[model samples]
Target: DSNFLFLFCYSTYSNKVFSVTFLSLAVAVIIPLFGAIILLKCPIDPQPISFKEPPVLTGPLEPNFKLRQAERLFENQLVGPESIANIGDVLFTGTADGKILKIENGEIHTLARLGHGPCTGREDEPTCGRPLGIRVGPKNTLFVADAYYGIFEINPVSGEVIPLVSSKTPIEGKNLSFINDLTLTRDGRKIYFTDSSSKWHRKDYSLLIMEASDDGRLFEYDRVTKEVKVLMGGLRFANGVQLSPSEDFVLVAETTMARIRRYYVSGLMKGGEDMFVENMPGFPDNIRLSSSGGYWVAMSAIRANPGFSMMDFLSEKPWIKRIIFKLLSQETVIKFVPKYSLLVELSDTGSYRRSFHDPNGMVASYISEAHEHNGHLYLGSFRSPFICRLNLKDV
Candidate 1:
């Protein structure tokens, strides 16, 4: 629109001039974004998890966790939801189908298709395995860390998806098959993310214990240098990656282990990592710090489905695991049914502060994403158009 746009179009990101265009807003409206940037640096003011004496609920009526169907958007299914990012009022989520969604005012719409593949019927096989992590920034920039295609950036309004970082360079597809959550540093100089597993894609979660591979890793991408560096290596399903409100520490969810760990960025414990919460009631999928305080943790499933848990128990027998997987893969006539419930909300230490669950399997298993926007918690699935919204005030 103006020369001011071209002259400063590619601002330095990571290390180089990346693809984002930053427009200074009267300088007054910039405060909030700046405040969010500051969130990336506050020292890790961790509320230690007293494991020796885990907190317990002493009351009868815990918040009811139930899932009531709301509405439908597409006839297809969802993969794992890695991270849910809110931009303004639009809630954008990335899916296994290589697509990102723009949920506006309670209506569903596709924001951009990041990659392609067969799981969701896309022509390009590599782009379609699954998309997990997504974040929206001040200028409406959408950054996504996909399971198969690595990392991507998109224009929320135009559907222009760009490959920002892929396993092509330092890390290869063989190294990062399940690229998980991602976050931008407060200064926007570095982008951090995780690869949940090297041996398991969303379809192969059953193999995590079977393979026992030392694969999960955390990485930092420098835009200015166009280099992606490893921060933490060898994790148990490196699932959720979030920066502390102060931007001083990075919190990562080890879903396969049902615990959240904090990696310091700046502080007395820089480079140190410790447990924030462990043995979540269920497998922790993703975590978001609420504007009002407290983190919303989504327990992907209260427990692995009986069929899957059975496989875990029979791990010594590979043939049994294989046979069961094959059977359950085709167990349904309609391909899916509302069978179980997955709820996520505030957790008071080891206690459940409040939760939302939708059984009957309507919400499905292997929930990849969950986030809280305003007072409503949104859920994205790995199997159906299982996008859901629950009123968090009930908690």
Candidate 2:
């Protein structure tokens, strides 16, 4: 009887064990298969990006606290002063709400409007206009690059905004998705600008950078001919555009690529392109010419080591990138904002001149532009509600 009972119990337990084992195996296989299917269905198409390793960020600015102690001029009054232009004692900057604000003696006034409607947030950018670049052209005419409205020429005195080019307008059969930073030639015969991304709008900048999109481009618009030409294509989040002091070359910032490229506009190398500076520590935004004979580049956010490094590694894996991008929210994609701020100076030949850093962002962060005027450096930001001013002597 004892042998029979033991045999019966073993039979019942083995049957249950087989069922459990089978279920566990099925789940183990099906879970991964399901995930694979979902990933395959993901729409976040990404491409590979390869470049030389970045240089060491070390410099004389190891502990420089310049930006942290800088002065804030228009605190909490404006939103996203993306670029700066100075005429005499007056400062002009573009805002997120499609308005160009003029600053004089610390007072702020609206200079022009790019759109007809009020933009309360990013969703209304198309309707309300978001000006990303501003420059003072010939005869004090303000050139603005609105993300949604395309290129514009604003009369600083009359507050009149004229659309020089619409975003819907196509160049070389390609329409601009985001018209970004702009610069005008000395003789005012031409204007150069960047289209940050051909696949995403200004509000989706996080996605654009994360995806490492190569749809960004550099363009030139001839004022006399009213013709637009694509000077460079297949760029990675192309941003700020500036011409060489001698007007022989144009520099375009490829933000996600962490580099600047020079397109020869004149001289023997005319129509050729080359790297100006490579392997930057952060995403390059607007670059401006300094009164001291070099250029100042605003490093929007310093690349966060470990985290950003991992992302860059994953950028090469298309399948992994698609899944991660599909699951990540826009805020989470851009949540890696570094607390540090930076402004790097380079010679006209693209050699390093100097660098300034704010390790804690006590004074400013996400600075998009740096302009030198009257011995003072006025800084703009993509998100800061104020423009910061710093003394060149102190720096």
Candidate 3:
């Protein structure tokens, strides 16, 4: 009886081990098979992106918690104030809900509605009209670059909206797909803007960055002549547009490449292009002229960090990006990116002056632009619901 009991216990143990091994083997085989099938069915055609070595976070590029001191303005009252423009104390910004709003004395008022009906969320962005770059144009007017509907000239007082450039307007034999940021000349006659992508709309911007296609174009528009001309082409996710104080050369932020490019508009190198700043510590968004005749570049994503940067790692690996897109949705893929807020100041010659950081993104993340006015910096974001104001004297 003793021998029989011991044998029975051994038999039971052997069966349990066998069952566990079988389940492990099955999972090992099934997971790769499912992944292979998903990779094969991926729709994205990724292009190889050559990214420079990330800059070292030393000297002026060192990380800090300065941005944590930023104060929120009109918190939860609006959403996605992506760009900010102002005349004296009155501030103007475009919100995610397709409205151009005016803020004065802590009051928010609608100046103009670009799209009809109620905008429920981001999915309605294409139809609701996502306004990106806003600049104070000639005669106290506002020039807005709407990602879906093209550019418009809006009267700040009466809220009159006039279409300056249509999305259907073709330049260089191609229709504009993603009209992003714009900068006007001193007289606001000639407008320079960036078309972010030829294949993706504003809503699918994440896909454009993952695909890393060089289909972006920079354009020059003459308000008087109604003529639009392509200034530079084949840019990778071209974003912000800013002209130098002298208006000799214009700078465009190539977001995916983590660099700023200089295109000569009225210099000895007219019609030529060169690198303004390369291998930034993060992806640059909108660049505005600083109070000291420099440039304030807003970084949407920090590349150099202790944590993983999925976008930075995928920059050189197109096959990996294809697999990621196949297995994960756009929203899921974006979740892999770490959060951080950063802003860099560049000299007139593109030298790094200094940088501000919210390394943990406690106060703000995905800072889009920094506009300096009256000893303060008004910050904008594409993801944050409210704007931030940082006192320059304190920081």
Candidate 4:
């Protein structure tokens, strides 16, 4: 009897120990899992992607490897030259380091610095400076869109920078953030720009793209009234803006959607937006008017292989996407990095004319905007440390 009682007591104790150990292990694993979920705070309201049509593939006449032969102008001197403005023989651009630089007489000069600190990397963006969009207006005023500093007008010749609008300017009771690209009306009375993501700052652009949130907005600032109006909202990562040659419409690049949206500025369709182009071969960044009577649309990277289907598959599974956010790094999660360079030419009617691809990314990759000036294509990139120049006539 004594031996049986002892055996029973030992069995009970061992079972309790096993149960406690299992429970502790489960808690240890689950606590961090839950913590990560809250920390990510992924708010992805994914839009439906209709794959009824895909962007046209490269044609026989399309310049594929030709872009690889481009000359690296201003080599390694600039960082993230996002957009360009040309005046006479001078080319002005905004760099990732928050400085407006101009290249004249084959020499690069600092026109103006938006921030006071030295831009060592993206982490110092707030102190260092990051200018994204640049446009030249009447009287030689350069309109600049600083990702962190709102909008400013600078005199390129005098190196004088004047703050015109703050990124925090409220529209319909909401404050603006991530003021990205800007375009001036033909009359120069108003400035149209895109707030890339109201939810994410410029540093967290990868997060914004991965989350695929519709937090992007478009606005217009009146030079005379000194008022800002939200022209359109709920854009999925609006990046670039350009007015039509006739000023009748404006094209806004929806980066996440990989297409362009046209907003009618004048005419019966004024105040309305339509899908200008859909299912682009790659993610389009900036659209600029070309002297050749077409538009130069820059694609940051070509969506290839698994990337094309992965985004579609993940967009539907927010739960899985949250896990991906928790597990993957920005460089690993974002597929639209500096893998390929694609420049697309489109007519005023939004028809595809031709495409130029540098599959190897030898000369330029991650292009943000390509402006054609004086028979040459001046390329801007959000990832490259140099601006690219390609002779269009030779191609």
Best by TM-score: 3
Worst 10 residues of 1 by lDDT: 43-52
Shift of residue 308 alpha carbon in model 3, Å: 3.9
Once superposed on the true structure, which residue ranges of model 4 sit more than 4 Å away at CA? Answer: 1-53, 56-63, 305-309, 334-338
Candidate order, lDDT descending = 3, 2, 4, 1
Report the CA-based lDDT of candidate 2 relative to the real structure.
0.84
Ranking by TM-score: 3, 2, 4, 1
Error of 2 at 313 (Å): 3.3
Candidates' C-alpha lDDT: 0.61, 0.84, 0.89, 0.81
Better-scoring candidate (lDDT), 1 or 3: 3
Instruction: Provide C-alpha RMSD values for all models, in order.
Output: 26.2, 3.8, 3.1, 5.9
Q: Write the per-residue lDDT of candidate 2 for residues 1-395, one digit (tens) a residue.
A: 99999999999999999999999999999999878768555445677777555555666424477787679887899988988887889889988888899888878998888787767888888889888888888788888899988988888888887788889877777779888988889888899999988789998887787678898999989988989899999999999999888999999999988899999989999999999988776778998998767899998676553335554566577777776666776777666555678898888888777888887577878789998889888899998888999988887
Q: TM-scores of all models?
A: 0.70, 0.89, 0.92, 0.85
**Highest lDDT: which candidate?**
3
Cα lDDT of model 4 by residue, 230-314, tens digit: 8888888889999988888889999877889989888999999899888777778888987767788998666554335455455
Supply candidate 4's per-residue lDDT for 109. Answer: 94
Clashing pairs in 3: none
Question: How does model 3 fare in lDDT?
Answer: 0.89
Candidate 3 lDDT at 16 equals: 96
